[model samples]
Target: MKPAVTPAPPAKDARRPPYAGYAMAAIGAALFASKGIIIKLAYAEGIDAETTLALRMILSLPFYLVIGIHALVHTRARGEALPDGRLVLRTIGVGLIGYWTSSYLDFKGLEYISAHFERLILFTYPLFVVLFGAAFFRQPVRSKALLAFAVSYAGLALLFVQNMAASGSATGTGALYVLSAAVTFALYQLLAKPLIMRIGPQLFTCVAMGAAGVAVIFHFLATHPFEAIFVSPTLWGICLALAFGATVLPSFFLSAALKQISAQANATIGMLSPVVTILLAMAVLGDTVSGSEWLGAALVILGIGWFTLSERKG
Candidate 1:
């Protein structure tokens, strides 16, 4: 009998992406940028950050609860055990820091600075991830990662300097708040890496978000009256967008993306986040964009895209 012929190996260029995860990251990044727009719009109606945050968490809370319960049931039916006590508590802690604290800071900063300014600062979270991950987790800092970091930050620095020259340092308070938000979010990314590996993205995100939701609930109750819910119709509509579009969808997308990609890689892809916020702010809020801002944004885009491509090849 003749020997059976073997099939040829696939071409190198034919390597396929884990599309679901990549889509999640890209879509989630856009949705996150959208939140800044929505929050700014709501703030126009005179709502404080806490009230806006409470509305978002409360509206999005049920979705997280259902997702967590569903995950538990599915795992149980598959004869897989749930997360242990330690993991659960750790998730809660990370969630409070990442979601509750970071988001609160973000909204507060938005009150003082423009949406574009807030987003640019918040986008620095990836750099913070590089620092904290290396320091705490001993994650190797690759040369390519460093190059990408330098390129992206150079862009941000250009924008910051130009904005300062034109507008002065009046936004110092807002910048500080947004910077704190970025750091906490970076901490969240560092904390999430191992946890996502163990418990799966869905369960981990659900648990963390739920913990954050509860914290926000307590905060809102402590400060605001029950009638605070009865905001103007426009603000109410903005709240819905914030809840579903920004919070729920992006949370799922980020969680799923983290499952397939390293947190640093995922965060690097998010370099486009500020661009999205800038465009939205220009259209919705009439924020003026300087020539320097345009050039800076281009640099950021190049750096992030180059890094993402390099990672895919490796």
Candidate 2:
């Protein structure tokens, strides 16, 4: 009997330094951070969160469609075997809930919450990623990983400490929503990560984004309608920026980065996003963080850095 062939290892050493991957992850986080500030600015101009998200998705539609069409043409010309139809369906399903619905919830939350506050909650993604990874994939939980997780949560507590004190009561409604968003966002990263590994970043993102765009467009018509979207030029411009700069561009970089980094690393690196958003808010929105917020942001960045940098190949 003939022996079976085992696949060769990836060309680049698996144990090579993770710096380049971390750098790309940082860039992707920066792009994502730009979204909240821009969305807030658009809100100040009177565009509602639903309308803003819809418009952003709409503007990004053409970019994804163009890529998908191009791929279809090229594949037909090359007579390559067709991709599995079920894969497309799965991508669409995840994109609909993960990208479209989660984004809607996030923007809506931003309307009611401070940018700093929103960021603090969002950064909980690292813990969710680690948990999801362990539960689903049985990834090992190291002592350092546990410590990093603890520090990150401590940062989140510090940022929200004032809010919790001010509340003086717990209804659990608002916090529940934020927690839901965080979980969905984490699932988004985890679900897409495997697809990205399978299909490559560009194609996966294009299809997933197209799916998200379609869902959001339908949501806009059902909820906001055409008049809401066409209300003003400033609103349209903000939406355009959200599409290209916030949604489209960042997602591509993030999807690509996922190919190079673990989901846990991606979430950890995204800890920088809160810092970037806070800085942007300060510059553009005239928002200033109190000493506590500053400390919280510092802790988040430090904890994430410790986790990513300390993970040396054994």
Candidate 3:
């Protein structure tokens, strides 16, 4: 008699647990938040923004290369077909635009603006997050979320004014540049989320970083003298820290977290990053942000909390 047929094993579920996702996101945020403090140190040592970007990418290249190579190996071992060239090309294009351009713009803005206020506007990524969610995911924005976004943006406005005053800039021109950086960053994050979904976060990030790194290296060669990179050990140290801490660690953790959480949740957690950045700046750099900035941060946090806790109708 024929033996009874055994049922096939159930398929693996790719969806990650919510708590795990949120935790990874928090870790990513912490790593990213620390970037400002490191950059300030690098700047103090006379490493200009372009050089910093190049060096950071240079330092980060190995880590991403390992991940990318591993991805290729794993796919080959599993006998799975290669990923589509079109997808890779798309990632390369978006990565160049998002990672390289956005990073340069942010560093440029930071030169003319306070890190804390740059973070404040940067936190406005949630606005773009929601828009992306609505447009791509077809997520219905609940009223509470709308309210939260409004409150947070208001806080951003306050921080903007404070940043201008702190910089002693004329007519808030510096703030406009900061705002422009924010807008570009929002676009990048939104573009990245979907791409990360298609390619596993680690593989996706590795490739993206590779794309960005290549672009930056070319730009560095074209525009600036190579002498800036060899200036001093202190510069090298800061650049290494920026790579390991700011780019590599944060990108990996954030991508891992994205596996579990929606883009909106990621954006919400991102709001906390600037607050952490501000505290670190004060502690490390002896920089002073006004009371209004503090108040604005508090409001932004509260708004984010309210949005997270509120229920949405089906």
Candidate 4:
């Protein structure tokens, strides 16, 4: 070594992080959209909703528990106070309602609907977020937001026309279940947002996911047999995919993406999710969309995209 030359400092990043952020968001959304498709596939294997959900939670539990432990160790090293009892209880409650309850309804809904329909219905959550924010958080609802809701829902209603035409399908009931899931999920976001601000999202999510995992376990014990978990190999694959690929990994990716970009941009770019779901549903599940249904999907995407970005600007 010539005169103990100091190693050159690491090069600074010149490329803005938004490129990676957008890619992560898009990939995360696609992975998330795959949840419905995977759920449908598992249903075809004749797994009940309770057992199916429990399997997913059980498989995903390790990821959350590990994160939770990491949080604890990190906090201790930093001499930070641990979350108080109130915060812990609040997180548990949010986890129950948001993940357990919402996922229960969603899986039940998937029993009766195509993945395509399920995705379209779930995409309506932004509208519920607006309403919930206005009603509970006292956030002022602007005209543009309302207009966005109207346009999106009008598109959804047009899809309902497709259901109406194809009578005898369980579309009505499925739509209700999925819509309930979206509302509860929105509520979870609203309630957890403040707590997330107080305690970091990593810690909050770890706690919340652990709570939801416990709930699913209890539900499984109450409603399913012990032997039920040792089912067909394909079902196990689906559960693993949902737990890791769709749930845990993409969740982290979405969180990391948020760190790089604003939530507005994340949501705006996430409009691609339904498109991903649509393509998967069509290709993998052989589901078809009519012209009117395609129009409805477009309207939903455009409306929510507009609403999120516009609200951010305002």
Candidate 5:
């Protein structure tokens, strides 16, 4: 009798480039950059940070709910066990740190700072990620990574000095808030990858976002009246855009990208964010950019682009 043969494993698509993961990270960063612009627009209508955040999470919740439910059902049909309660709780905690606390601080900071300044400050999170990862996770810091870090942060320092000189004392308070947000966000970047690898990216995003949405909603309810959420149709439209475009899409994209790349690489790729935010703020909010800001931005782009190319080659 002839022996039965097993079919060969399917080949990976050679047409798809290795850099696709980097492209996903870039797209995620660009979409996330729009978030500050949209939130600033909502604030222009006299909405408070809590209310704007509430509206964003409210609009965002349904999508996460649907996706979360679908992912559970799909996992069950595939005969897989659900994530344990401990991992689930840990993910929820990370979500709260990353999304709820960080976002709240960020929204509050925006009240006192320009979107350009806010984004640039937030861009420092990658430095925290690299530092924390080396300290806690024992990840080695390569010399090339140090060079990239130095170049990027030197540019940020230039922009920071320029912005700080132009703004009021309130800038100090805002910078503190956003800097705290950056730290928590950096922690989130460190914690998320292993969890994402265990569960799929879609499921991980849904669970994390679901927990964050609930936390934001509860915080809003505890502090503010429902009437606070009522705003002009235009404001609602802006919140809708912020929710779907900035929050939902980018969350999923970043999660998926994490599955393909290291967190440090993801954070470095996100340096594109502040530049995008600067341009959008200029165009939409009539915010002016200085020659120094332009030079600093050029430095940022050069650093990130060079780092990305080197990573690809490596």
Candidate 6:
């Protein structure tokens, strides 16, 4: 009688390559960079930040609702315990800070600053992420990370100086608003990791987004007239594009990437965002780019590419 053959089990290292995480982060950052352009377009249509954000959340809510329900059902089918109330609440809180508060600040900042400058300011969130992670999470600060930051922010400083020279003190308020958004977003990235690990990225993203959507809707109703929701079809189309292209897809991509990479790495990789936003601003908005801006952008890209290669090797 022939002996029964045993099949080989999968290899321990069969998981995705680290580059896959980098790729996901890069794509997410690029997509997210489109947001500034879209918001600026909406602003040109005479849509205020409050109404724009409200419409974005309203349009995005249904997708999160459907996805959240599916994630719960899948968890049950897998015989997994559902997230406890505490976890759910914590996720929602982080979501509100990240999406609701951060987004509001960003939209308001866009009103005062150019899209390129707004993106550049917002791109500084990684510094906060690294600092907060080290302080609160006890994450080790690698020397390479500092070097990458120095290089990247050197470029950012150049752009900041040039923009300040050009725009003067008028950019101060918007800069502050975007900086606040960066801080909150940094907190979100730091806080979300453990929750994502426990509840899974798909469920966590859905819950967080759903909660933020609700919060934004409530805030809108409280501050704006009910009739403000009725906007021109062009604005609605812009909101739709913002919801799916920039918000929904990139949110999922980022959440999934977080499952694979550390928040520091993910945030650092987001340096690509400013470059994308700069190009889009020039192309779509017909904004002018200075020589210093080009040089600053080159440095940003160089630093990011260096960091990405280092991460891949690690």
Which numbered prediction scores highest in lDDT against the true structure?
Answer: 4
lDDT of each: 0.84, 0.76, 0.77, 0.87, 0.84, 0.86
Stretches > 4 Å off in candidate 2: 1-29, 74-79, 164-176, 251-272, 312-314
lDDT of 3 by residue, 122-142 (tens): 666556666667877787876
Candidate 5: tens digits of C-alpha lDDT, residues 1-314: 98999987667865554487888899999999998899999999988889999999989989988998999999999999999999899888878888899999999999888887788767667667877999999987767767877887788778777878888677777878888888889999999989888987667878888899889988998999877777889998999999999988997788789888787778777877888899899999999999998887777666655666675566
Residue 81's C-alpha lDDT in candidate 5? 95
**Pairs in clash, predicted candidate 6:** none
Each candidate structure's TM-score, on Cα atoms with residue i matched to residue i, is 0.84, 0.79, 0.81, 0.92, 0.83, 0.83
Per-candidate clashes come to 0, 0, 0, 0, 0, 0
Identify the superior model by lDDT, candidate 1 or candidate 6: 6
After superposition, candidate 1 runs with Cα above 4 Å error: 6-28, 143-147, 165-169, 251-271, 306-314
> Model 2 residue 292 lDDT?
85
- Looking at model 3, residue 93 earns an lDDT score of 80
Worst ten in a row by lDDT for model 2 = 167-176
- Writing each residue's lDDT as its tens digit, candidate 4 over 1-314 gives 55987888766775546698999999999999999999888888889789889999989989888998998899899999999999999999998998899999999998877787788888878778889999988988889989998998898898887876785558888888999999998898889889989888779988989899898898898887788889888889989998998899888889889999888889877888899999999999888888998998999888888887887888
- TM-score comparison, 3 vs 6, better candidate: 6
Greater-lDDT candidate between 3 and 6: 6
Highest TM-score: which candidate? 4
Prediction 6 TM-score vs. true: 0.83
Spell out the clash pairs found in candidate 4. none
The TM-score that candidate 5 achieves is 0.83
- Model 2 / residue 196 / CA error / Å: 2.4
**Candidate 6, residues 241-290: lDDT per residue as tens digits?**
99998988998889789988887788777767887998999999999999
